[model samples]
Target: MSEIVYGNLLYPQDDTPDETVLGCIRGARDVGVTTFDTADIYGMFRSENLLGRALAGEPREELVLCTKVGMPTAGGPNGRGLSRKHILESVDGSLRRLRVDHIDVYTAHRYDPETPIEEVMWTFAELVRSGKVLYMGMSEWPVESITEASRLAQELHVPLVCHMPRYSMLWRVPESEVFKTCDDLGIGQITYFTLEQGVLTGKYLPGVDWPAGSRGTDLKGGRGPLMRHWLDADDALTRIQRLAPLAEDSGLSLAQLAVAWVLQHPSVAGAVIGASRPEQLHHNAEASGRPLEADLMSRIDQILGGDLIVHSA
Candidate 1:
């Protein structure tokens, strides 16, 4: 990989208990995950508390901790968006919730169209100057919003160093321009959905029963095409099946294949993998150094046929 290791992982804000949450974090670190990605809004701040407990006694210097703001913490008119008050309040709250002195790379969880870019950029600049946050950026932001933010930050002399978005074979919207923009601006791209919510794990074969808790079958409000509502429940099942041979050719598990494929994109800084268990994390860790042959990569592109995903720059 690129000099930077992929340890910054996303921990979903569901009802997972402390034991389960901490177990996963410790499990990740035990297996060499040196960075973690979380947000103030994750799990209604539940995940952060558990994550904070997990890193309580660890050596802080050995890790890169990042958390995000801009989303509502308790859900209210003022509780959400990228207003100066929300950004300032939540950055401190994220620091408190994470139980860390300062966040390594604090990001706007998403863009806030209502807020002025100057206020948002300088708010983080103030955080950095106050030594509360080291660096700042935005995630899941549209290209124009990001461009405007970067421009304002630059004009104000504040550093915006990262851009977080979803990028995978299933969701290639970022490929269009966000990747190129990241390259041009020298901003790091941290991508989530690298496995398409476990869709590319290759276990959801056609006609097979849904595994007990697989995201496709059981994840409530999952972003999947429904057979009843859209097409059949097996939507995209066939397309994924066509991807198997390429994965096998590279000597990788399908999940590894998906993540590795994303890594092939030069603009990607880190692919956030969600681990429900220790063994699953081990599988992801192995993907870090595996190389995808050029022919195998080309084959995957052919399998996922369609017009290329485009995002306005």
Candidate 2:
């Protein structure tokens, strides 16, 4: 398929189309990002509606639509997980908001430990069979869980096609074994956080209030416990400073350089760009076109201290 270019439009709760996103969506369409990533619990189900309205009259066929289910929420008992209730209810709710008959890719937002895998697989298999979801995938899944999921899809005859993982210059954990596993399984790997939530963007310096202008600064659920804007900011700045010359020689911005690094991998199918505004969208789109030189990649590996890969959970 023509290189799948998608954006993670996360609105996790009644978030309005802030001026930035309104312009960003217009810019995305101006460039060539027609596919979008979203989730049921994003903005408490308001994210999809906001996106749906922004993209209201665009031709459905022109867009490759996708969304996710199975994450914690505030609604009710069926508000989370991959139980039959949540999965079925979520798909309908998502469809209603997205205003689409079928989703190109409907992913399990996370592994639902409380529910049986068989139930989740069976319910989703039926959705695919009924023509609601064109294809399916798993996100933030452990390698073993993904293997198990692949096996279940096989026995159930459902096609599990892609994997969404956090992969970037900082989070290279997927490289440990996830990339190889995906390669062996024939599942494409789509990555996000490629810039380590903008740490790799070469923007943050040793002491600048952690660059409050970044999407990473405004992420939902707060930064993870291990990674805060302040604690890691110092090291990130140092790394970027060290890598500046390499990016300079290549004539690319640090953000583009980091993204290009992720795309250089054989296992990466595509990189997901999260945009808070139009210029960022254009900037991200432009990065895909910039070629990552081999020598530059080697330099980055050295500057990042050690392997910048993420460990499998």
Error (Å) of candidate 2 at residue 134 is 0.5
> Each model's C-alpha lDDT?
0.73, 0.75
Q: What is residue 27's positional error in candidate 1, in angstroms? A: 1.5
Candidate that scores best on TM-score: 2
Query: What are the per-residue Cα lDDT tens digits for candidate 2 across 181-278?
Result: 88899898878666665566666677666567454465554355545642464765676678877877787777777777878888887787766667
Supply the global lDDT for candidate 1: 0.73
Question: In angstroms, what RMSD does candidate 2 have relative to the true structure?
Answer: 2.5
- Give one digit per residue, the lDDT tens place, for model 1 in 69-144: 8776766868988888888778777788888899888889888878887788878788888889877868988888
Report how far residue 115 has shifted in candidate 2, in Å: 1.6
Task: Point out the worst 10-residue segment of candidate 1 by lDDT.
Answer: 1-10
* TM-score to true structure, per model: 0.90, 0.90
The TM-score measured for candidate 2 stands at: 0.90
